[model samples]
Target chain A: MIMKNDIILAGVGGQGILSIAAIIGTAAVSRGLYVKQSEVHGMSQRGGDVQSHLRLSSRPIASDLIPTGAADMIISVEPLEALRYLPWLKKEGWIITNTKPFVNIPNYPPLEEVLATIASKPHHVMIDADEIATEIGSARSANMVILGASTICLDLPFEELEQAIRSVFGKKGEEIVHTNLSALRAGRDFALQHKNQA
Target chain B: MQKMILLGDEAIAQGAIDAGLSGIYAYPGTPSTEITEYIIASKEAKNNGIVANWTANEKTAVETALGMSYAGKRAMACMKHVGLNVAADPFINSAVTGINGGLIVVSADDPSMHSSQNEQDSRFYGKFALLPILEPSNQQEAYDMVHYGFDLSEKYQIPVLFRITTRLAHSRSGIERKAKRAQNEMTLPGDLKQFVLLPAIARRRYKGLLGLQPQLENESENSGWNQYTDGPDKSLGIIAAGLAYNYLLENFPEGNIPYPVLKIGQYPLPRLWVEKIANECETLLVLEEGMPVIEEMLKGYLGNCLNIKGRLDGTLPRDGELNPNLVAVALGGKMIRGEEVPSLVVPRPPSLCAGCPHTDSYLALNEAMKVYGKGRVFSDIGCYTLAALPPLEAINSCVDMGASITMAKGAADAGLVPAVAVIGDSTFTHSGITGLLDAVISKSPITILILDNSTTGMTGGQPSAATGRIAEICKGIGVEEEHIRILKPLRKNHDENVKIIAEELAYPGVSVVIPTRECVQTLNRRMREKFKNKKTE
Candidate 1:
């Protein structure tokens, strides 16, 4: 069977959601699957909510936007942003998100309420990705961690995503690439552990 | 052949380059900015000696592209939908003037106001100008249409309007490449009076354009981009245009759209195929991304015999962008109900950067204008316009580009002493200079605050045309040299900036206060590049 994954990557501006989309999109293309990724730019980049629709399939894709309630997964770099796109998620859709909050706006809800709302989802894996990335020696690789957690929902191979990370981050040098790879593995390990326990 | 992933905008740019484009003129706006940026970054474009640069605004850009076409070289002018409003005069006249070489005007419409002021469609503009329009259904089609658009422009001797919306313009997909073609050599029109739009010449040119309508329609029918695909079910015939066609196909991923479909990529209404579908199906559903131009045309002003369904008949939402789910619902598919978002998740509006110079400028202005009270300030479009939001409601009105100066002048004339105008450096160069000249001529009692951030901050830090020349331009515009004040907009210089603004406001004549600083985003980018270079060394 040909694999198809419709993922929505959500975050505030400057959270590197486009980077995640680029990494996964490049990996999907290398696997000879057709990929369509829709991004938000311009005025929305000034600390506003942003999301990218990423679709990968064996057959040719049609629309650049993924239909409402058809997304297989939503990988968010912020806790509140993860909940913001719940309307796009399937009933069984997995929401793998970072637990850290991007508190750019005033009147931000309590951290516990945001966490509880995300936990209420039928299928969700919340990880302290920033902490894990910091532990992995690259504070900026938190997005890589979220991408790793999403690998469980994606149809592509883990090794392919690893290679994609190298291809995308290769210019930054081998150390940065290795750190991001480690962060990805740590996230995958956390999600796998949670899934096994469930 | 190698394939590369490209945004819809980039695909169009690459298509133009491969189609032997000699130059591309554009103003930096969302979704459309990347088109010119791609050409500017391409080594191939450099090797081919293509002229790609940001113009002051869309009007000058279109005229520049028209001039290139007059010289018998293929050129392109791109802008967002509202930008078309700025370039409407030259754009409409370019069709009457026709072309010596191919010219494609790419207007990327923002259907949902993603980053724009309005969601106006560009197809109406195409029809109004009596020019051919090509709306691509996908990135590959966006790539291929440039070649066809240029050919049609050359053959018809008219500029082609290439329309796209936010989704397609910002989206990315893989596109295949074609062999490159050579740019046209410099040659003029055979007739010396071709571009002369005097009354007598214009009448003959208008007649010539009218005569070409049939050929344009025939080309549209046979364009192969517009197709009539028959299906087993004949209950409903779908007319899907541009990105709307993609949404329709997405609903039927099995490649089995039961209804007969007329996929329309080229315009002039392609009557024959449309007639075929209308004759076959019981009902007609027009799926267009923007307005109901096709639906209204097919249904006429009165209701037609066929059950015409679309934005008009309430089959789809009357406004906003059409997504696959909405198309699915229109096609009688089940509406999937998902989890609702908690009300606690408030809206996150876009704001200025933390250390934005606009904040300091506004702070000083508020302090200086305390005695005068609120609602005396007018602003223009730029990052500084964000001051209208909370924490600093510094600006009162934002009408359009260059309107700040003129509006402030009018207000100051109407007994509002010391009326202030806050405009950006790029916006000043774009349209504010003329208004300043008017202020100088009338000696309007307005204090113009030119926010000189050394770049266009709102549109992601494109280089400003007013850089290093604001003072000279102000002086040349006849603002008194003594009253032309420049101050650094920073917290450290807040009191000094406020004193200067107060002094300018106290003056009865036209005065300009320029708060000069580099945009923090661009400064950071430069710093990072410098650090990278040092590391490399």
Candidate 2:
């Protein structure tokens, strides 16, 4: 059977969406998957809501952008950002979003309402990637933690992601790679336990 | 063959490096910036002695590329769609003075206004210059096109216009590489007077350029990039150009679309192929990114009787980029969608970073402008343009690069006293210096705030041309030495900075206040290496 994973990665700009993309993309490439990840650069880098359409397939993929209502999953680091891509998510699509709210706008909705909207989804995983990353002693590893939480929905093996975290962050140092791996496991463990509840 | 996943920009860079490129010049602009950034980061390019310089502006970059071309070596200059306008003088004239070496001018158009002022197509500019244009359908095609483009440029002794949209520029995919060719040795043009475009000489060169049109058209027909595929259905023929071909293919995942499809990756229209397709189908659907250049061409001045459907005929939206669903719906598919976005999710517009120096500088400028009232401040391009939004709402206008200074001068001429112009440091060097010269010549009473964050912050912190040299440049540009105040744009220095700005605004002549600080993002990027070093130790 042909395998395909069309994920929409969403978050506030400067919130490390591209970093998460690097981990997932690196893993996808290692598995001999055809990958097409489109990103937002330039002005949006200054703390704006940014989304990247990441498509990976066993065969050749065409569109860099995933069509409306066709995304397999939306992996976001912020709850509010996760809801913004509702139109792009498939009916039975999985939403793997962090429970933490990145409130940069004055009119940002109440955190409870944002969480409630994400919670209302049939297939979803809400993990506090920030809290988990902080607990792992690397607050900046929140992006990796969120990527880990989405592994349940992703067809790829969990071990592949851990290996990716090492290769992707390996340049920074062994310490970073280790911390990111810890953060990834912390997020994955939480998702496996909460999959049924979600 | 080796394959690596790379963005479209990186593919172009890699393709150039592999295809015997000697130098790459560019001004940092969205989409196009990454092309040069890739070259700068490539260790192979460095070892090969390829020069990648971020020029002061697009114009300088293009001229530098032309100079390298004059020395008989492969050279490339890239810029965003608007940046092309700045580089137009050299870009257009380079065609008249036919090149000796391979020269490719890459312009990345941003459709849908993603990170641009307008979605102007660059193919029209290529057509105007009468140059062969290459638009890649995929990342691999993008990489392949660069090698092909260089050969074509040298074969015809003319510059090739390489156009790509935001999607292709920012999009990443696996690209297969070809064997690397050696860079050209330094040499001179065969003819000594080739570049001198005097009216008499230019007339002869112009004729030569125009004479190459038919051959170029024939070349496009056999280029292999402009593919013609036949399908059983003759009722409708589809014309998918550049990146739109990918979206068209997405709708037909089984590798089958019934209608005959003509994938146009090269330009000059290849009239015979167009006519052949036009004759075969009852109706034509033209799918192209940016404007409907080909569609409009198909519907000539007399308005052909062919039922051509595209952006012009409402088959596709007149504005913005194309997607797979849009192409599907245009092909008579249903409008499929999922859940509506909750109304509670408010707009989270981009703003200055947490420790952004522009935040403090804009705050000080806002406080200084209190007595002068609103609508007096004009801002230019860059991260500082973000200040036009709330809660700072510091600037009033953002038209184009270097427009802030000239617009402020114009406004001050119209009796808007104390008209303040807020321009970024890189932008000041790009086009603002000349505008400042004009202001100083007339002694315009406008106070200018040169927000110096030390890098081109908007395009991801490429090394700035205006770094540490802003004060000296302002002085050199005829600004009164006493009136050019350079201050640190910090929260602690906010009160003093505001006072200085207010004093500058009170001056009867042109006064420049530069609030200098390193961009937070650039600072963070630099510190990461230090952090890594500490960890390793």
Candidate 3:
């Protein structure tokens, strides 16, 4: 079996982008699949852009960068960043992006314009992740929300994803653990409800 | 026991704790910070009376660990790749002054310049010091290596370096940990002459280090971590090192590869496997991260028939960290899509955190130097260096720690008016103090702004070395008390601080202005702790 999917997740630092990619990668690997991941963050503490690439398959991943037009999916936590990586998405590939942009990036594309561009694509999910997160009790967790939304297109089982999340962040604290688990469930539910609407 | 999830760094710390480490001393740097933090916060570690604390800098950290080792205890000194340069003077000399107990130097290298100035390979340092180096391919190896590293250090009577790169240090994997080992009995150094590095004794210890090299290499050849794989096909052999070998195995669909594989984790190349793979295969690909040091060495040993290929042959990019895709390309397989990378806009450079004291200090410095314009102020490394970017381009030069003070002095001596140096509290402690002493002795007409944020600030605000005593140290170092000025750096205090800065800059002789404030991050942490304490109280 050939390993074919390359997934890139990009957002400003402090968005929990790394954790999201890590969870999905872990879930895939736990199922006896091969996975490779690379992360790039410049001064992560200062809130700069952070990008992580996850390549998944039954075989070993080859490249660190999700080459242009080769990304099976690009899960972005911010709208502008999703547009930033738009050129990398395959013609029919899926993009799951949150509507609210991180306030830090000096100049960002307007939310609607970004939504319109993503809508132009064949397969896309534009989520008001912050709104969903705020309803779920924390806007800081839009990352998991987007991750959950993207799972609609990925081939992994929901149980596997949940197990990875529990294993990864369960040590953080019970309250935080419950809230984020709720957020992930909310995201997956949202995606399942509106996946084909666009 | 249940499989507990652990970061590679945490696993190393767990392994150290399991190995009954006496202490962990380190200067916080990315990829290495979590190791020290893990030890400090671990309940099991603290309950076992293990000591873990942030050292002033990498040099002091290593020296303190050496001191612990000399007292017949296992000690770990952790530092990032460049921090090793700061600690190299002691590191190289430590080989000559052998230890009484186990000493493990944890060097976490950033192969892609990830949060670092350079991508230097520290494995070379191990070879240069004639020290046995154990590299782990995954988190389990990282943890297990620490325990094994201590045993090896004790067995060989030499310090061992546990080398990890960004990937191994940051990645998370399932790690099966062993039961805790009993602590080594504390005993003082037997021979005073052995600990002292006087020329006579140093020469003898140097000979001892050299004598142990052969045995170390032989042990490496036989190490379980170093494996020789035999498969059905032998057309093209692969010599994969560290995590690259793990990445390579993913490419083969079946458990067996089409060629013989020499997966190396121990340093000082396993010659037998090299000879075996080289003699059988027509072409060999050397896969490793960072530099082509191993490839260079392999080429010399293998005849022309081996046809060695790696970074040196442009099969791999000579720079940046490697991933499996890069290794697959070296193996002559299809590159990861072989598609062109989409263009990305040049990223906006990193800036100081919002409400950071460095931001306020930079603003005040800019306001004070509105007349001097852009090119007058010099700065050094630390959080304040971020002021060189947009919104507050106050600093002019930053070349390593302590360069600001000395470089500004040189410019002033060469006739630049109102020359200034701005260094963070942590950077000053790292190297700026001696430069300040130089300014005082020379009486250079330079204004040095010691931006005291009371934390390192850049690498997540581990306690600043000069947190409690920059002022006293400055006075003790011979700067005139009258020439030293201190001001609280805050938005409300900005005007007063700027005025104080102006007055100090106008002074004829060497002047020191310390704009003081606790880092906002630290302040928040303190606030949280205060709230927690109130509840407990």
What's the count of clashing pairs in each model shown?
Answer: 0, 0, 3
Model 3 steric clash pairs: A60-B250, A62-B325, A63-B325
lDDT per residue for candidate 3 within A28-121, as digits (tens), equals: 8788775656665336557776777777777544333455556788898887677666656676778888878676656644556656766767
> What DockQ does each prediction reach against the true complex?
0.84, 0.88, 0.29
What does the lDDT read for residue B132 in candidate 2? 92
State each candidate's chain A TM-score: 0.96, 0.97, 0.91
Rank the models by lDDT, top first.
2, 1, 3
Candidate 2 chain A weakest ten by summed lDDT:
A189-198
**lDDT tens string, model 2, B1-537?**
536989999999999999999999999999899999999999999999999999999999999999999999999999999999999999999999989889999999999987888899999999999999999999999999999999999999999999999999999999999999998888899998999999999999999999999999999899999989999999999999998999999999999899998999998888778988999999999999999999999998777688999999898999999999999998989767779999998888889889889899988988988987888999999888888899899888999999999999999999989899999999999999999999999999999999998898899888888899998998998999999999998999989999999999999899999888898888988898788688668
> lDDT tens digits, residues A1-198, model 2?
899999999999878999888888889988989999999988876789899999989999999999998999999999999999999999999999998888788888889988988888899999999999999899998988898888888989888988888888787668888998898888888998886443
- Candidate closer to the true structure by DockQ (higher is better), 1 or 3: 1
Best candidate according to DockQ: 2
Q: Write down the worst ten-residue block by lDDT for model 1 chain B.
A: B297-306
Candidate 2 - CAPRI tier?
Answer: high
- Superior by DockQ: candidate 2 or candidate 3: 2
For residues B169-235, what per-residue lDDT tens digits would candidate 1 score against the true structure? 9999999988888999999898879999999999999999999999999999998989999999999
DockQ for candidate 3, C-alpha atoms: 0.29
TM-score of chain B of each: 0.98, 0.99, 0.94
lDDT of 3 by residue, B200-243 (tens): 88888899988887888788888787899886677788888876
Task: Please give the ranking of all candidate structures by DockQ, highest first, separated by commas.
Answer: 2, 1, 3
